[model samples]
Target: MQNLQGKSIAILATNGFEQSELEVPRDKLRGAGATVHVISLEPGRIKGWDKDDWGNPVDVDRTLDSVSADDYDAIVLPGGQINPDLLRVEQKALDFISKFWSDNKTVAAICHAPWLLVETGIAKGRKMTSYPSVKTDVINAGAHWQDSPVVTDQGLVTSRNPGDLDAFCEKIAEEIKEGRHERRAA
Candidate 1:
């Protein structure tokens, strides 16, 4: 695995996040020697959404109201239909995500999580991919939507679905190692 020792990663998610999407990357990053923290909108734990039912609960390490983008080297946004749908409407979440982009920190998203990217207004003129159902939404947000398993543009990394987790996690670690990236203006 890529060595990410000394790096700190923040995963932003809420209730309803896809179980695998959140857990896999968290485990992968931690295994790579990076410190990983799950930040949510509240204290305590957030429940995940499995295929047809609710999944396990993950403890929140920090709340949105108590943390800033400057606290971590990178951020990961995990997708579940309901997770992104709910987060997209949250101004605090959007602001926190926007700060990462503005600061040029690595921001990775997978599956439906790209919806947060859309709401942050950072999708314009970037190449990204998400769950098939989100293709049109991404395109409509001015992003160049593709059908790849994983796509990376600047410091932004995105993937289509849970099946793409391996590639997605790899790209995320690669991008984090590369460090901050200034995105080209649209």
Candidate 2:
């Protein structure tokens, strides 16, 4: 495990996030010694979607309006059918993600969350992967889509789904530890 001590990471998410996609990475990252913050659209607790139904609620440490991308070394976007669906439509959410790209910070997404990357115009020309259902959307966004457990390009890390959480989390930590990447204009 990479030593992420003193590193601050933000998990951007909201209600309907895949239970495992969000929790597993958040817990694993924190366990790796990174300071993790659960950032959402609003304050209070956000509910999660388990396999087929609603699961536990995670506390929100900060709201989107309250923080800037500069505050964290990396950002994570966890996917669920509903979560990314909701986030992709929010201008604030999209803008927040764009900042991460402009700053060259590690941007990680899993499952359907890659949709957020598309909406922010960050998908184009990058190698990425997401939930099978999101393949069309990613490719349509001009990304070089791949069928893999995890795919990374220029500090952006993406994974297929919950089953790939282990690789996803590990890659996220590795990217953050590598520090900022020199990325081309998006």
- Model 1 per-residue lDDT tens digits across residues 1-186: 699999999999999999999999999999999999999999999999998899999999999999988989899999999999999999999999999999999999999999999999889999999999999999999999999999999999999999989999999999999999977887
Model 1 weakest lDDT span, ten residues long: 177-186
Tens-digit lDDT string for candidate 2 (103-151): 9999999999999999988999999999999999999999999999999
In candidate 2, position 52 carries an lDDT of: 98
Candidates in order, TM-scores: namely 0.98, 0.98
lDDT of each: 0.95, 0.94
Error of 1 at 165 (Å): 0.5
Angstrom error at residue 124, model 1 = 0.4
